[model samples]
Target: MSFVTLSNSRVETTPPVENNSDSGVLSPEPDASMQEYYQLQMDLLILTVILTGVIFVTVCFFYPLKIALNYLLGAVGSVVYLRMLAKDVEKLGRQQQRLSKARLAIFIGLIVVATQWNSLSILPIFLGFLTYKAALILYVLKSVLMPES
Candidate 1:
């Protein structure tokens, strides 16, 4: 058995193996900005969930259950859609792929149906749609005003 001692006096005994034909080259580690970007993504997801819960609870007091549900559904759909857009943009690059018109049409259709049904309050639903953007703006403002050292 062999041991490798580290500067901190820790010993690692695992033997290194010779490269094999089946082994693939390892990818390089992610840079600091990439790590920060993913961290922000996680933070945004957490904030969205919290915001959705708060909106659902607060709106329940003034609106009917159905309306409140619709508002939550809209808000959740918007957040999912925005997250999808972000992922697409990241994967395909902004210049390579813009949001499709069909997606916009479908979203508009949802709003129209909700409005026509009269069971869903347009105001709350619209506010729900804006929830993700509001959260994002707050996050950006916080990051800018109180930047990490």
Candidate 2:
């Protein structure tokens, strides 16, 4: 081929390569922070399902209590139940502070209960629920009870 013809027919076949990362797009690394966050969220969801299952089992285990208590702790109102649960935890704290040795056993028993209750996950839904109620009581104590006091 003549130099002029060869030069005219020469082609540049290299296509333009666009960088996705440079354009503010995400890469596909599983250990990326976003992926980690998503994984943590999924792990939390699984933990929640597991915790709920354990609570269901615990409740099932306690099912006979309802029948047994038909006469004893009779149909207490919701308000009464809340007060009782709150006072019980408070009394436990007070008794723990006063007689640590005696309360230690109770504390250890609670620890065992918590452990057996949530062996699969260390999540504490039962105590957490009680804490939420305590917090609500505290909020009320601050907002309403304090002003009155």
Candidate 3:
């Protein structure tokens, strides 16, 4: 007998019980909360790329020496900012990681800008940006792909 057998009067049929191992069946869509988180993460990843390019170009037009000094200051600033972010993220969650990652990337960008003044070091610093970009991209991607623990 079917687990979902119907009665005789004005009968309506109900679906069968879903088995856990049914891979052929389409799974349920992500819930609203998960969808929102995914959207937020995707937005951040795109924003990071756009901002990185804008900052790189903007720094180029500004005074090379001043940019170098500012960049150095930014590196120092990141140490302090990261400390605060680390605490906030530990206490709260991924929200603070976004802020922390942005600050860290900015600090790295400053280092790159400084290197531009010394042409010999520019290539190495640019390579560093690639790593920074990858870090941000992965952080954002992971946040989207994985469920929050």
- Go through the candidates in order and give each one's C-alpha lDDT: 0.67, 0.37, 0.46
* Candidate 2 C-alpha lDDT tens digits along 47-119: 4344434544565477553432221211112223334343344334324443224333433444455467533
- lDDT rank order: 1, 3, 2
The candidate with the higher TM-score, 1 or 2, is 1
Off by over 4 Å in 3: 1-26, 63-149
Q: What are the RMSDs of all candidates, in order?
A: 10.5, 26.5, 17.1
Candidate 3, run of 10 with poorest lDDT: 13-22
- lDDT string for model 3 (1-149, tens) is 01344587655533223222447553345445545544554454455455445555566577485454353344334334434443444334323323435545555665656666564344334443453345466666776898582
Alpha carbon lDDT at 23, candidate 3: 70
Winner by TM-score: 1
lDDT of 1 by residue, 1-149 (tens): 12365756776442222222244543344446545655677688778778888888988988788878877877887777667655554444323556554445536766787789866767777777777887788788888999982
Candidate 1 minimal-lDDT segment of 10 residues = 13-22
Candidate 1 ranges with C-alpha deviation above 4 Å: 1-28, 94-106
- Residue 135 lDDT in model 3? 41
Give the Cα error of residue 63 in candidate 1, in Å: 2.9
Pairs of residues clashing in candidate 2: none
Which candidate model has the greater lDDT, 1 or 3?
1
lDDT (Cα, 0-100) at 92 in candidate 2: 48
